[model samples]
Target: PLGQLPVLEIDGGKFPQSLAIARYLARQLKLGGKNDLESLKCDVIVDTMQEL
Candidate 1:
């Protein structure tokens, strides 16, 4: 299983990383950053969360 959990599936496509999966869902669901600044903020959170 590659030792991973909470895999994301969209349109039959699989994504393993939580941040990438979250970003994809956010964009598709109209909850993602609408500009560069917001995108940067989201990225920062993603990075910090990965360290936890």
Candidate 2:
């Protein structure tokens, strides 16, 4: 969707972008981190990787 690569088609919905998909899975699987800071770090790394 929205011309983004690696779209995730799940539960009859189309979610776009790798980061979006990863975050969804992380929340569902309890792997986003133990607290807000940890989660922010994970997000920063993922976003930086995407930028790279």
Which of the numbered candidates is closest to the native, going by highest lDDT? 2
Candidate 2, 1-52: lDDT as tens digits: 7888788898798888898888888888998889999999989988998899
Off-target runs (Cα >4 Å) in candidate 1 are 1-3
The deviation in Å at residue 47 for candidate 1 is 1.3
What does the lDDT read for residue 30 in candidate 2?
A: 93
Report lDDT per candidate: 0.79, 0.88
TM-score of each: 0.72, 0.78
lDDT by residue (1-52, candidate 1, tens digit) is 3557768866796668787787888788877688989888887887899899
What is the RMSD of candidate 1?
A: 1.8
Q: Give the Å error, residue 50, model 2.
A: 0.8
Worst 10 residues of 2 by lDDT: 1-10
